[model samples]
Target: MPPSLPSPSSVTRAAITLPILARAASTTSAGTAVTPNKPPPSKDHHVHTYSPEAFPLGYTVSSTHAGIKKKAGALDLGILVSTSDTPCSAAACMTRNVFKAAPVTVTSELLRNSNGRAKGFIINSGCANAVTGKKGLEDAWSMSNTTTSQLPPSGAQSDKEGTLVMSTGVIGQHLPISSILDKIPELIRTLDDSPKSWLDLSKAFMTTDTFPKLRAKTFKIGDRLIRMAGIDKGAGMIAPNMGPPQPPHATLLGVIATDAAIKPEDLQNALNYAVDRSFNNITVDGDMSTNDTILCLANGAAGSAEHGGRETEEKMKELTEKANPEEFGIFKEQLREFAEELAQLVVRDGEGATKFVTIRVKGAPTYEIANAVAKSVANSSLFKTAMYGEDANWGRILCAVGYTPLSPNPISPTSVSVSFLPPAASSNTTPLRLLTNGEPEPNIDEARASEILKEEDLEIEIDLGDGNEEAKVWTCDFSHEYVTINGSAEEEEGWMYD
Candidate 1:
């Protein structure tokens, strides 16, 4: 199920209350240092805000010294190192695309080698360590090892902690590790006990992403407040995957940190549950990445919830979900909700997306089937371009289904039925061959169709007419802007390709 929107309380006041909370939280911790040219609250849904008190896991972030994609700059790298060996857990869902990136491959190995034990996180934006083969792997491993070595030795200094690393931006390029190494010292100096630092870290991960993405949660155990913070990077090429096709399952790259006092195993379980409900539930491109990673680290700095403080528990429950009796399920639910919201923001800012569209597929044999059909519609360039042109071309939607993996190979030429809701983008004055079995009349008024296409949100559903599989995928319409964003580097600065 597409997870029903949280109780109206969670989102209803989010717009208004969230801002007050962010302001109050910011002023209390870091004073009133405002950012410039900040857009008014009502203008864009592409960015959201939260309180810092929600993440107290003592974080130290530094940038990548290597600089730009092809040039050297100041502070483009970052690290999220924990001060303690706090127990942590995570769950991720990556791209199904076969050409996985080097960073994704190495990070998967590290996570598997450590068995959920992640110490710190390393990330670079200018280059995506992909398609470089052995040398790329070498670069990824070397970067991981360097990050591992920088941590304050464990033994007596701190308990045991694991590390996760991520890279984003144009694919098929090598990272400038030397520049990153040199800048590490200076980047480290900027780290203070402030939330803005982590926000800066999130911003540094952007490639074509227009804004920093982040989410935080705070829960009170007994007399203490436990906090978790996360950062993600994705503005394009997103999709759903079945994961490894077997075994321990699949994962994604979503970095989350918490300052809760919980056992490592417990944290892992919580993280898994959270990801399943959150990141795993979304799809943007139907084209998975080779470098999708999400790692969570914990440093028991805030201490766990005391078992007896009823007062503290109630107060914490107001903002943070409770974890006892498992009744406090709201914590992970809210996190997933916020994360989905963040992911949508990425799509709204999708390189050239002037409008964000949501494709909902229901009434199928299973969620998987619905998802398959959804992706077919979401990823089809025909469907996308039609969307871009504001043309209600149901034929394109039907064409997408015909090519989808779900389409019966031998081409069942029959046994399938499809339909579109009223105001569909079709110009057939007469009811055409819209229904194969028990489907709607395949005809729509051109005027109504055009009006429907003008709306910002879109919903498309398909009934395989098979059993009852259900799936839903999300994507933006293909526009000339998308083309422009994907063009050569020079075109990115100015000039257009005629």
Candidate 2:
């Protein structure tokens, strides 16, 4: 692990009390969940707030200048620990890339062996330790074992503290193990829970991200207050399509810690649902990373029947058919919203990207088709370049839709319509139709089109005019800076393993 660690400098509202969000199923991402913009049905506006910046109870993070990056004294190696005495429930969505990083392979086994329980995890940014074959795997194990050595161990040899590992940056390179392991004890000794610590930790793990990406959510399980916080880093080699401890993962990279009590199976299910709708729905440059991983740990520090910072060991109900659906629904939505916020941050900070675009493909025959078409348009280099130049090149967008292997046969060029939606907070209620029924508009409002595309954030709406199924994907525009950065990356000391 060589590239990143979170350096947290977050602000927490001690008085913050989040309102209850409704449990009813609604329409949104992947054509199933609630829309990212839709607020909870509750009259109160506090049901969801994006950046509470508070770490959940019982979690601590720290990073050190491990010299993993080429930059002198840059904080690289970091550790995030679930400090509860009991083994914390853990779940992950890992990259589907066949050339999985050494850390990824080791962490997968750790989770598999521990049965969804873990204590602490470590991440490094600099050398990805990918494509190094057996020796790379050994280094990953060393990273895990070294981390386990610092923290108190958990049950069973198969479950040795669940010391998961993650790495990012230059591919096919060996980690400076001695240089990193020397700092592991110091990282542990300096572990902290301060907002500044979280901010620093967030920044440490970042590669090309201009700013640290982190968010927090709060809710109540009965009278007990539950909190969820997440931090992630990635500015390139993104487009996470992770599975539930299966073939793939997303976000490029993310770590979520929560105090909400949940069962192992329920935790896995919630992560799968949230990730598929959020992280899996985004693409920046359409590149999949070998080390992409998102791990969620719940220490249950604020479980029911607790107060004054004391965590109860009492078993809480896991989300299941036998449990309360409302509470479970709220948990899943909060998790999704948290992941979505972080995932969006990845796009907003995409390397050399100047615009964040949302592609909404509606009236499709199926959710999969809608998703595929939307991603196809979002990932089109021509379309992205057009957006970069503030050009309403709607043909480029539609052409992207034309070649989709998953497209419907009836969806001829004439079967679709394309429009540029107004930017967020803009007063314009009407969309500027660039192409309607697959025909270019007779009188193009070039001025208005320029105005819409000039904004830093843009929205593209495509109507297949086929069926009710719809999907939304988030992406960024291509720019000359993207090329410049990639061109000189290797000489600059490191580049992400795409």
Candidate 3:
């Protein structure tokens, strides 16, 4: 396991209060649920208002109200620029949906053409340039070109300083290209390396997100301190299929900036490892969007140039091959933790979702089977509804697992078992064992199981007893509000900002 973060007492008081304040401000009217329309508090505690800054050096963020969103003054366009003297090395993972958006196409081309180097990112919310065909492509290209033209001379680096674009909101709509272009100058002028700027950038990219999602951590390689800060916007349509360094997608847009001096290829490898274990392991409504994207930029502002020369490629290759385990492990762990935290936040704030559910499938014949089984359970409407109702309905889970089409390896009913574990705060309570060897436990306490299911976070463990392989997935309970929110998404788009 990665090292545990020090308790807030060991860190700073803000470390404990910031997340609480952010979470509190994001709650629905009932104070327990999350809704897409709730705007973040005006005085966000997540900003560097108290102690300990939230971002790495050499990175600045800015946002502007481009009049794309229905609400006046709601920030709809944003940019994050890496101001390192040298070009920033970038790694990205985009959605695998075949029907990708225009911005996704442009981002893929830029990553390919520029060879994984970028100066900054340009993002817009409230008008997803998806399914708009030729015109959409031109508009996306225009966004990048206009943003690039506004950069200072030092910030521009020929083809090396590629600009990535991300758009999220109403699909099949053309972007307000003129408004976005007009705001470019102001956006660039407001860029600052402050925590408030990062927080604003996070909020600027939200479509239906109830709160700004941001996380930051500081780690050390040798004696030099390196910081990794990330912000993401996603609340629904969030089953991200983001694969290794690729393109872009919709709904989810994450940007992680680090000051660690690492090669682009190595950064890509680290991002892939982290994404597979984090974003790829989560599901919210199980509807993958056309514009899911996660981008990581390393500007090496910390000056740990131990891996900055031509020999760096060979060293990175060795690290990838596990020939140099220590340094590679440190980088991989830090990146994974960063990605995992953001991914979990996405699920925790799943639109109208009341409970966070973790589905763990164990004893499968192979990891692939375990993963499939976990996803089947995680995405099951019956299981999710049961969870939301706090019902100890283990049969729904078994049905989901059994119908997963595992091909030739038929599951043996007699070898199945299931258990429900409550949240960590209730450690004094024992896990409720619902099944044993495919038979309902004779001493099962249905009331206890139902009570445990009422917790905000739940863990359902399934044992196939087929083999030793295991996989885990994160999901959320499906409530009536989930259906209501999605059902009205189109009709209520204009009023969501109210």
Candidate 4:
């Protein structure tokens, strides 16, 4: 947002200048054709997604308010536990911010010490436990220890390496450790595998989200049925660049639990693969969070108790091709669909968001170029505002594409083309081209384009006419509600998060 806007009390969804598009492109402007990677598969190739009604095997959830949130009655604490007799294999991605929140540091350490195994997650809303120095670290460790200590022997022989912690809210504030600690027992007492409890657990850890986000999938390796479920929360600070306990990540908190037996190495591989096409591919405000973390736990409850899941997810050395054991391929595809669904939910629930925008950049020489161009457009405030207003302003979208930094091989408008495709979920396959092969569509249909913009979901198709590689990004349109939400945020005396 610019520093010089007049009183906006009366205005809603006003167009605000964004910094990214303000600067001139280092290369030829988007007016020229440029390169991007490949594009999304045709609609027929869309992943077969599902809405599982049952909970993932062996996991139960409990949630309660512990006065952590400033709002009274706001459920602020949650526990997601795996009751399998043994510690479940785990894989996690955390924020790479230099000033990582206390919980992120502690959870990452526990996963390391336990060698990618854990009981479950203990999360709190309100204080982020970031930048509080040593005290924050101690509180975070205690959060994990205290929550796991009360549970039966499971993931870790000791409680210290059992539970993971996730915290979201305001930064630089200390959590009321005593109060949060006191309520841990109550949370455990209320834990159950009921559907409502799982939903409650999702909302309890949310900050600015207007609704809870969760998804489920059930598939079998051979004849053994395996179930997976995922839950996540984020409305702002949601540009996730997470890696496997590596540098760079998102403050967007998420968990995908499955009862498919898999090795620790394979579980990590699955998470790394799905995240690239899922959480890491979506954005809200483009601000990476200090507390961002995504954890995947496989407790193997679907298999016999004596030996865990009957179908062990074999570790695949290469994910881009078919696995030697065929079954791993099926598991990877299902995992990708599940992760993508959870990530899309965040964009759909973006703070003050009005439109869900899908950007596909195709024909670039490399994945890096395609991803960069897609993000350039996805993060543009100007393009988002245009979508919010339902404006058929193709110029804003083109301008955003033009400004991407592609030195040494700058974009040339002659071969570049742009179009608004029919809704991805719709049966329509035809695209309404605004520009084709570097020339504006001679017979463009303005009314049809306008109709496309009116739809809640829209897809922008850009082709560089360069190569076969491609990339996709999912984002939402910023609106008047966005400015009001960020502009009006004020920390009260007692409330910390949100």
Candidate 5:
């Protein structure tokens, strides 16, 4: 639920600026097309895309903050209105933290107020309206209200185009809402449904992120085939949560749009289920944030009324409930796979990260304990530092396992088994110096370990040997460049681990 919105006075208005288009590639994929040695099945996979016509419900998206990362200059606010306003339906997942941002709080309320229906999103990045107390809350709402004043109500039984607002940047600072508000009119005047428009709106909401993250999928919900478009932003302060109801202190913001005809309740249910396995399951540094948010807006533009009125929603609900694993198994797998790809992009872009690390923990007391242990090890600065140094620090791995709270009783260090496989020719590997726990086989080679650490992808496995519990954690090796990029390390390059 959203906190009480302060009176409009809490927020002031700045003069409006003319909307200007940014110079970016019309392409909507996350970054320069990933050139894999062996590219996946489809070069242009469904994992990240934005087809202008995908959303018949049409959309109105815009950004007020950009150009900060470069500090070269500034541009006017951006806006992108879709081509249609058909009856829409959508679902979303958000950061599960208690000190939620003002935008997150207000969005939840708007979702309910609009009765689970919405038009699209309006977002800004330079300033995050977080922890500003009453003023922040009012400013977030004010953005929504101002957008509402300019756009027409989505034509539906609900005649209201639900507007969602999002923000990202420093926490606990006052947002320059007046500057954002001042540009609303110009933004509305230039709202075009162009590929460039989509790209600009996406680039507008970036903080430290280097590239834009987006995806599109067409799902067959009965006889209706609906297209879903989504965009997300996150580069630093990541460590998403699943077990806890509240997100850790890391934040992620996203906007999902679809042009399908479905009720809000149904949309919410489907979205919740999708997110549990998607965004909720991923973690980077084990830290969460106060500004995590993922919103979905459906305007029912496609108008597929197979199950007229509540009938369509009811039938889909029944099928979803029965969990006919075989019926929509294909759809489910695609959705899950798409989400994993999206989450991987987040890890690949971790701040100052150079080596992508995958930590797999097996033989734990329980799944819950396994994850806790995995995260404890993965998020450790010591462990990550060791990876960056290319040192096979087996002791840190064992130490992480030993500190895990999952053990029901005390267990000797001998209970655990750890191994370092030199990198395969096709893949990257980690250093294999045995620090502790396992005796180094007399034949264990040293040159092989060094060669393996040079690969771009690295994998590490820890066998707790305690129970059957297991978990997987994704992370990156800490390098001095990371410190330099983040302005944390005093020297231009990071110190050597050795």
Candidate 6:
């Protein structure tokens, strides 16, 4: 079972009292006024910031502080809206964790009720609405209803037209629904489709993250240009297992918006394919969050006939049968590439991470075996620490691969080989072979191997010598600072509630 929330009596009283305290401070007598004690600043905000270069067409983003976070002027609430004339097509990948947050539950129901269509998303930081049970669900519904109420009426409103909600930060706390609802009008009025708005929205979603993650790309499909922009927030508890929207359980929240108008099924297929190679292949702390969500909204505002139009049904059918190399291949590849870039940025900005590492496994009998082997090596603490210390400990790498239990087809240690390469910037460097056929290579240069490990980025390649299938996993070296950041997180937030 998930963690239990605070006792109802104490929680209810605190919740009812906080708003009264804020209001009391403004009350004044004829001659004098009384001042209420102010809460301490939140320790959650860090120095890292970001600036976005471009934003997707037909989308506007904005953020504001709603007192969920104690820090003054910190952006704790945000919303992203699609401004197309018609409803936008949507695709989502959610976490598979059993204990889902309120927002995750609400979003999943909304998507199913609407048949994969939505107009906007509302996100909040500093209070993750998990473990609050029935009341949490009610609060999440209130958030969506308030947002929809504030928007201009377009025809009739249904669950499908409701905005998606996402929350991050401290777990097991009830959201300050009153404060959040009060800010809906201001948040709606400030929405803009400018680059700065996107950047601010990205920053508003951050928690333990040291920096914002944002990426944008434009692809041409026959004379018309379609643009996609994405922003994500994760620095801890960052392993993600996002899949189709049915049983949502991933925590690293990401939002991708595009101007291409594609069928919902086709968009969902593309999102799952991209996630398998990108988000699913990276690990920060090897722990998954209960609120992981990746959503993509395509508004088709680019006026591109080739991408989406009256013939969308036929084009989607053709894509399902077999991608047309000349037509669909370019768009598919661009989407995958953009997702991969964003995934890499997540690792690069990992909390206290100093070295970015890539683990590649080849020659496996199946893609599943290849992925298992790569992740085992990438998530091993001994290997990560060895990299942080600049130690060329190839034995640790080999040990991790040897323990990956491959069912049906057992791996033979005698058929495995390992090699490490220097950073790409070093043109004169050569890859150092550590093992051949499971034995240490003769006359190996330990000095050169150690030199390669000193670079900020490195790659380790492993060959199972079983078949031709391959997989790649991205990770970062573990450092002392990582422990320090996590060790103090709970203490920092604990003071706020007290």
Q: Top TM-score: which candidate number?
A: 2
| Cα lDDT, model 1, residue 441 | 51
TM-score of 1: 0.70
Per-model TM-score versus the true fold: 0.70, 0.84, 0.84, 0.83, 0.72, 0.83
Runs in model 6 lying further than 4 Å from the true structure = 1-53, 154-159, 247-250, 304-326, 489-498
Give the per-residue lDDT digits (tens) of candidate 2, residues 1-498: 111211111101210221111222355656753312211122122122343234587888899888888788777788898876555888999888787888888888888777888887898877788888889999999988888877755333234456889887788788999998898999889988887777777767777666777677667767667887788888788888788675323127889999876776788888998998889999988888888899999876775534633456664445552476787788888899889888888888787777889999999988888988899888889788777766565656756776666612435556788888997687775788877786667776677777787677799999998899999899988777777767674632644443
Q: What lDDT score is found at residue 169 in candidate 5?
A: 70
Task: Give the distance in Å from residue 334's predicted Cα in candidate 3 to where it truly belongs.
Answer: 1.6
Best candidate according to lDDT: 3
Q: Candidate 4 on 112-176: residue-level lDDT in tens?
A: 88888888999998778888899999998898888888987764345445889999888877889
Q: Give the CA lDDT, 0 to 100, for residue 454 in model 5.
A: 52
List, residue by residue over 1-498, the lDDT tens digit for candidate 5.
012211222211110121111211233376542211221112122234456655433565544433322254433245444435344454456666677778877877776666665556677766667778889999988988887777765444354545677777767567677777887776777777555566677667566566667666666655555565666777676776522122223257666665554456655655565555456545555668777776655554443444222223222332232354443444445455556666666666666666677777777777666666667678777677766666554556655655555434443445556655544655444445342233434454555655555555677767666799787777876666555655553121212100
lDDT of each: 0.55, 0.75, 0.76, 0.75, 0.57, 0.75
Task: Name the lDDT value of residue 322 in candidate 3.
Answer: 52
Clashing pairs in 3: 249-291, 249-292, 250-290, 250-291, 250-292
RMSD (Å) per prediction: 13.7, 13.3, 10.9, 9.5, 14.4, 14.9
* Per-residue C-alpha lDDT of model 1 across residues 1-498, encoded as one tens digit per residue: 123212223323332321110110113255653322212122244445765555665566766446645444534588876654333433333444577777767666665665555667778776777677888888877777766665666432323334566777556566666766665556555655466777777777776666677767666544665676777776665543423211212112457676554444444455555554345545544456666665656555664355321113222222223336343354455445545655555555555564466665555666666666666677777677666666554655655555556423222324555443432443433222334553335343455455555556555556565565565455676666565656655311322110
TM-score: model 6 vs. ground truth: 0.83
Worst 10 residues of 3 by lDDT: 16-25
**How high is the lDDT of residue 466 in model 4?**
83
Query: Which candidate do you rate higher for TM-score, 2 or 5?
Result: 2
For model 6 the local lDDT of residue 23 reads 14
